[model samples]
Target: MKSSYTVENPDYQLSPKTGMTRSHYIELAKYLLEGAFQHIDSFDDILTFPLIDGKTYPQEDSPAWRFRSLEFEALERTFTLAAPLIHNDPETEIKGINLRDYYANLLYKALTPGNPNSLPMPEDLPDSTYQYTCEFGGLFKTLLLMPDTIWSVYTEEQKAAMVKTISAWGHHRTTQNNWRIFNITTLSFLKKQGYEIDDGLLLNHLQWVVSYHSGDGWYLEQTYNYYSISLFIVYTTIWNRGFGDEYYPEISKTIEKSAQKLMESIGNFFGRDGYINMWSRSICYRTWVSGAFPVAFMLENPNLLDGGWARRLCSGSLLQFVTKEEFFVNGIPSLGFYGQKDYMVQSYSCPASPFLMFLPFICLALPEDSPFWTETENDGFWEDLGDASTQTLLPSPGLMLVNHGKTGTSEIIPGKVYYDDPNYSKLTFNTHFPWEDQNPDGGTSMEYAFRSLDPRDLRGDDINFYLTGKTVDNDSELRAKFTHSQNMLFNGQRDGVLYRQAIMRQPPNNGVGYIIDLAEITLPGGVLRVDRTRLAFEYELTLGHFGLPHIDGVEATVEERKLADRTVMIARIPGRSLAFITYHGWDQAEAMTHDGNNAEADSSTVLFARKTAPKVNPKMEILITAMLHKMDDSEWTEEELSPVKDFTIQTFAPSGSPCGVQVNLSSGASHHVDYQNIDGLRTC
Candidate 1:
């Protein structure tokens, strides 16, 4: 059968399109739900859905059951959206399936005692896994969506069984991160149903969540990433709206302010095309990033996001994912973002995890006459700010973002990456290029080496860093607490330049150390990296230039040329050009290919410049300037193409001490970088 929907303004090249209205989204959700149910003979059969890539994830219980819960979770959002229409209009149906009967039957089968399809109850073990907590959250949410008629259909025993099931979940221990919401939401639902719950237990989770708020409207969930904002917004909004005054009045008050702060910060992550920064985990839940928008609307003072802009961003993000043909298999969303690329999946993510993308459909809960539905769509900040280049420094996250409106390219340089995950550790994240996982050596803007060590020893992998480090003084900043295991001593950023001073410990030789200093600068389409080393004893040092994205069969070419005193290595690809110019400390440049290292399966080519300290002096310093021009070859002359050549760098000290550099761009703008400053440098 033909697809039942299409998206408005679909980017046919990127996503698959079905339809664009609320009805279309509802139909799509229903279609996916039906497709999943078709594979199951009974609810227990949900444990038999095929795992993507035939990968086995470690779990005592079958993982496929999670998909069942996820499917129900997605349906809950659809049902809530359809509740008003189904109740107000008797003739309403989604894809010819009567909404009320369809949902009521499913809910009854899943929750009714002794039903073959009933979900397993929460285990009473003290160390029970968090999955049970998550599953219970979904079940409780689905029941909340039931209309009065559907609610009345449930026998008293069935309702009591659900209450007992949810009550057990509330008492069970859950993960301290986002999973806390599962307990909070479940208890809130039970309380709303007039069931008494442990007020202290509920209050404790709420207090922990509120205390976990780091700053600038972000909550720490394992590490700083997109989940910090997206999931936090959803859960807190539910708490504030459901049990605010009656349960935790203080939490309700704090969440309102935090939610607004988060809403204001979330808009920056989306590009003009509405795709979010692909820098964090759970990428399969693509449009769910728009979940924040719906949460904004649910707030009492919903002024954080304009109605027109909300619709645009929400619609745009939804379309970006839904339009991709590869997003689904047999009408069910696969375990990948656009297709079944398993590199991005975490251990906890199963085939059904992608259904979390349904969070945005919560907007369907709003009335048909709400301004969110009626307002003319606005293009959001990207369009509102015009084509001028703008930069925003998010201190809480230690992220510096530059949006080049004219070029439609945005780049983010994070000051802190606490995770070993490369998607978070990469020096720069670009909206146009989704991060790649297979090629660790490619797409990185910064890399370094140590003396006499094997390549593997010098290799930078899973380096833990964070932007939340406190500034000790004007000249030095403390490294984040998580980086204590590493040799880093002081870290600071000044005028768009990030700097660090550390003692490198050579492993296997306990006492050996090398004094290391590093600095970085990021521009719209370029980055500058510098490294200086002083060995306590005789040792060698090597520093690498940034690597550029390399896609096969798109006309790739590399050229080596001399510009004044520097040797410049330039790589040209479709619609873009990257130039790597080494000013002070490189021996040679080489082109290397990394397979499975990028977002796409195709290999990527990287250019590197290495520097080694002489044994006699054991001292070496290197500076490499990498610039990107976003225009295709046809758009510029040879002179205009080499933007890196026109840029000049002036050192603040002879040995690059204080590790300062001033870059004068061809545009006549100057960026002054002081490595000693703990706070990042201000841009021109």
Candidate 2:
């Protein structure tokens, strides 16, 4: 098929081929206008709208959902009302057109791509919040899609300012974890808005996106979950939009194909129900489901969307989520169905981000004359399913699967399980070992690093840690209580180990708000061994020559090897319990010098140098067995064993990374290990 944009708009005439009646196009424009207006009232006074009422508010306490939504609404409204303007007034009407000038001025004043002076971000505001990151991307899309009449109103300077601000904002520090792909596409969309930006950021964005992808049409909502199924449509569509430019034609083609696969996956999100499963944080941002379908359709061939009921799926699903009270008052989405009331609070979300659901509306960008606009909304995924099954949609590297299981419990499950690393934005949480009386300040300090698919990934929280552990007969007894505080206790009993993990809610400034623990048992004569390994996905890991592993009561023989092309490090430990710790800003932890003298003030630099790691949030199904044996059972011996249990974890560490295990071998004899390579498990 020919390019849809052209077929629909040759000399701005409606295409005869699409068979769309003018009335159909008008209806869509009207619906979008209503959406824009509905969210208009939700605008807060923090960033875009000043507290006109003249009340000062702290950044955290400021009225949320400010100008972000207003900007997008104005832009969309400008076009919705303007498409009819051109036909209504043809004589000198161009300059007199109110909607065109309104949109252009909004683009100019609100900020357009490539312009630095667009709007100044407030100094006291915390960029870590979703407001800053999500709005930029959302607004960028609205500006990118402006029609020619609206485009004609802005000065080159205004557009440039919008582009510049968005590009630079792309590098804003993500929470400890960088879920930047979502924002990078926002940056890419700005680039597509006709701005010149650094190729490095674009390349970096692509590298990270390609790296974090779990497979198929799905990317990790963040890093962990049933699997990685984030704002796939947003990132893919925006990237495809920018990649379409000739500057990177090859990448554009590849991304276009990727976009197609993404749309096909959207078809699966619909079960017998009109709704998609709610998973991960930002449950408030439910329109992501609708937005994904439209974007997939936009990037892929419309024909692909034609038979698959792409538009219907988005329209119906969006309508359902909104009617269900899942979204906030301003029409911004909710963080999730479950999570800290404060964390999942709708106030944390921005209105523009939710308008991402308008992605399907892009199909409206089709000329009023196109068949796409004329099609009835009936018979789509939402219509037929009509609230079928509430299933978790898990899109992987090559396939998409839905779990008929229950939704994630916002009510914390009482049990102690280790969270080695928990990524909220990408939606993956994991755990490894436990340290007892470990120096609180001995290790480099880290924060609650998380990312929202929205892009402004944030990472900063300072709270203290209070860890409590106990052995119970079964995993059933490990739980937590927070009558006056936010507390979490992991509870689970498997084999001989009773395990629980807890995050004691700290006063707002402790920076240490959550604690993740791994519950393990040291069987009689069984030593708990800790595995110290580094894993990477999209980026390379930088190891400072000075930092060394800190393990309690364990001797290590560390060796590095290549697994095919990737590198891995293995360290065998002979001890009952082992703890491996790595910290940031270690040089500051203790004074040191290169010559073994007082380390120069800058010597601590290695510890603080920004380093990257692979996001191995890959999913696998495996049967893990733990057995306790006599020191000398190499061949055939009888030993106590824990009942085998099935668990699903992000199983791929960097190739060759130690499996992180603690073991006790007879005083000096090393225990031999055997394992099977199962097909369909996460492969190297």
Candidate 3:
């Protein structure tokens, strides 16, 4: 049995790595849905959840949520969980109501006129931006993915009402990003049913999404966070499965190729044991990572993945969250990554929102003969990176994926030019160290920052990529120039080193920002960063490492090492370990603590390094820092905690950053970083 399975009675034969076979999935799905299912008393009863008054997220009565209905959110999202379950077990019953029959009847009432809980169609709603437009797409996808349970069983009148409702929602407004895919999926289903749809708009959406394709799959060019997976791939596959052949065969064929390529790259996103390195927003939708697989397998796409590897990953991710005893709250998946993690919930989340985590269950709908079920499970990248680590450079998204073999950690370093919040501008995001709890008193977010001591800066918090240097100058909406990074280059990394550059100023505006270049080398334990500062010398710089979960009644740090110009701090419990090192160009290091500020633990601790430029400042300044994560209790070796073997800076040539610098590690790995040609690079 898989050790990750915290619950008893796990099956190993079908899934040597996860014990999550077709039948196992059926059982797991029932357990998960039971939370919402137990409250059902009749075929037409809407699933209602009690609100915690002012504590309600998205604020129940706020103007932003004027178009949102708690009842509709609770009912529709729960059906997302029930759709696949009923596909495999059509006769499933809950609280004396047939799961399939309840949804079909409830939806019919919701779409028909005069019902108390009837959903307002797109035109009738206050505006086209109604939440119902985003929420109703799943109903159409469910009807298409498994028609017998809802669509086929419906009467002619019931079918017409739902279709008309979907058709209206199809024409509603959409966010420029992934929301457009929802319209495509729901409208494609209507088109497949021989109904009329604006083919121009439909084709337009397909073309628009295809335009995002940045090569090597994932449409990876700058697609942020869960937008790449949950919405884009999920609905695209649903549209492809239901109508791609007859509607747009050429684009469908291209999507198939892209999906296959995406599968290979996404495989690295998960560790050997299957914990997905999650970053960015939508932290509540934990299992959506598994959405990548089943659709490809259902279509029988070849060369997509090793069947054993796919299930192992799907199962691994499921076990990580589902096995936690605290995963549920009040009989449903909590609005947090784990149980009641207030720090993990987004402001936009509603109570029943987490029910959309039904992707992994799609495997249950696959036939028994599929390789996804027959193949023996095996480790994905662990088979290759036994004791080493490597990084994948995705040029379009300007992303680097690091696979840490010894400790089962996945780290992503993305080249971000502009950001609205800290979530987007962090130097890196790691699966092991999830973005820390965003509390005021909590340790700060992981970033390479310039804490503005100058009262001139309008914003108070430490500067991220956008340095608000010489603050208080432009009072026009607290102006800070974008760190435009169109020049995110890969000129280095000939030997495991990553070199890149980004201009930090808004040209044409004549803003005062730097043309900064950054370089990194991924070691087995952590990443070594070489950051150059061209900002004015008065601003003090601070580097914040990933926050470590702190245990109550225990010391925040297990051990710490301090040198004249270097220091290392380590924190760990039984299962997770974290290390932070300030190697060079820093004056002081301190570990800060906060209460109830972590998603995974009760408290969190972070090592923050601070330094100001020397009195005799040069045109360019450099800082080096490293962070490591592990899953074991062993102490770090000297080599693992040692400073860089060598670092060279030219005394002459005397321009901004040295034209080229060589930094080496004890392992004989060397990085030749050159910024001489940065002037010729592209500007964003």
Candidate 4:
């Protein structure tokens, strides 16, 4: 029963340690080099054609060429010039050294001295091409950091020129994800090369990064499903090198702690089938969860208690990804889950973006003696327990997950869009100013984050899943308290946090409610509850992607279904319906009727009303129902209940010491739920 119903995976040929016998590290290295060579002259071609004559360049051809030629050329030069340094001199002396430099030299000669069409361009280009250029910069930075190379064959003046070129362009840009990552990475490269740049400007850039930390390991991906954890882990790693445990030890420690929190997030994110929630913008940049490798590898200190466990937690997910061929597209890694079609790309991703997955190769950078390089793979977070595995429920947040066999969770379908845009997956909610809930209290706001952790792996004990989440509170220190039967833990810090826990699925037909209550929280002026629903949209529509309806003259209905000690209020309409109730300030937000038809309307449950039924005079009927409750400036509590659980309660939370968590469950009797098979997906 467990084998058939459990979320287990089939092995693939990728990882060296498990599944497929292929050496993926070597394949990935070839892929990265091929990507660099394949696009060597792409910028040059883009610069030669402007498309201003009103010619529509197919996606294979970028028309923004004329406007961004110089920027592209500079970026290309960054990569072209750094390639030679990858294999030679000191680096080649190290173990496992190989160099592929012909493409690098060809690309370098083509872009150096700066193509007139492509020099001195704004570090910021059209939104359409910015990510491509930045990624070019990232690749170049990675090449520069390689331990050896032919770069030393160049005169001092030439190497300095390269450093100056990178510094100038990287410093001028300013966007959260791009700038923060670019700055830290570039700064690390510069410091390594022994070049001097302004300390104040560099630190200021770091400070700006510090400001974006949202306490619980969240950094705004920006405007939409901005991925915070992946970006932060990478940026913090670069920053860690530059800081050297000096000025910002606390901040560094906080980031390390937050990285653990991020692992907890990844642990809950994957389902038993090795599936991951594909909810953010760079769906094409799918292997992003693996990007956390550098951060995890950095926490070598066992004294930090959870530090060692955190590394293993994150490494386990990475191992899960590489076991499958899902991480690559046409031999080159794609942007994410849906490949370039992923909604998060928003034109930011280019052919160069997925190479960022090489960010995980930072693991290779671990010295030969490092533990991560030698640790053996296990069943990971999904280890089998004595009886039935763990399960968790989050009702108000609209998420029901079950962890089978091990402490990890699972999802029936992985990477299915929870909203139209991957960005919407981070549903930061508020209770005040309903109309401005996402931006409550003017600028201060709250948001939720979800990530699918199944990297490209072929392991059988994989976790497959889709995660839907919402922020009930924007402030720090929100907690989900349960019995010793099971628990959820919380830890809040000034510079992000490390909150980790396992979420299990509730038993079938058990009306168990996992309440995620928020205290010291405020809602937007026009909102009642921020309900998040994950949907798979076959079309590309951006309007009302958050599940809010925009249909004019649409009517609504509301009803109250009572359970043992709770009342479940349901709002509906024929077929599919969406309801948006405005607070007008809580008291004023209520069920208002202006009817031409007669329908049963309950006071306790607000619903959109109509004269008759939609079957009769559907045209004249437009009823809206909203429930209201009043509260003054005093301590307040809000609770959401599930339909009901016949006879079981479960709780799980991260344990403080041996660095993990304790799982507790009470199911009345010994009969356990058994079923197996997990689900996972790969983008072809």
Using all chains and alpha carbons, the TM-scores for the candidates as numbered come to 0.80, 0.46, 0.88, 0.50
* lDDT-best of 3 and 4: 3
What digit string (tens of lDDT, one per residue) describes model 2 on residues 393-446?
A: 232322213312111111111121123221121111101111011111221211
Q: How many backbone clashes does candidate 3 have?
A: 4
CA displacement after TM-score superposition, residue 282 of candidate 3 (Å): 1.5
| Per-residue lDDT of model 4, residues 22-140, tens digit only | 13333434444443443334422321211111122125455555334433533343332234334322332111222333333433443344644324434434433344336444544
lDDT of 1 by residue, 509-597 (tens): 32234545556655445555655554544434433333445544353478888766677777767766656667666677666655655
**Could you give the C-alpha RMSD of every candidate to the true structure, in order shown?**
7.6, 20.2, 4.6, 18.6
Provide the lDDT at 502 for model 1: 42
Best by TM-score: 3
lDDT for 52 in candidate 3 is 40
Ranked by TM-score, the better of candidates 1 and 2 is 1
RMSD of 4: 18.6
Better model by TM-score, 1 or 4? 1
Off by over 4 Å in 4: 1-24, 31-100, 103-111, 115-120, 123-129, 136-153, 191-196, 223-226, 242-254, 260-266, 271-274, 300-330, 335-344, 385-684
Off by over 4 Å in 3: 1-8, 52-68, 220-223, 341-344, 437-445, 455-495, 500-516, 552-555, 563-565, 614-619, 652-659, 679-684
lDDT of each: 0.58, 0.34, 0.66, 0.35
* Candidate 3 lDDT by residue in tens digits, 375-433: 87888667878878878876555677888887777777765434424445566777777
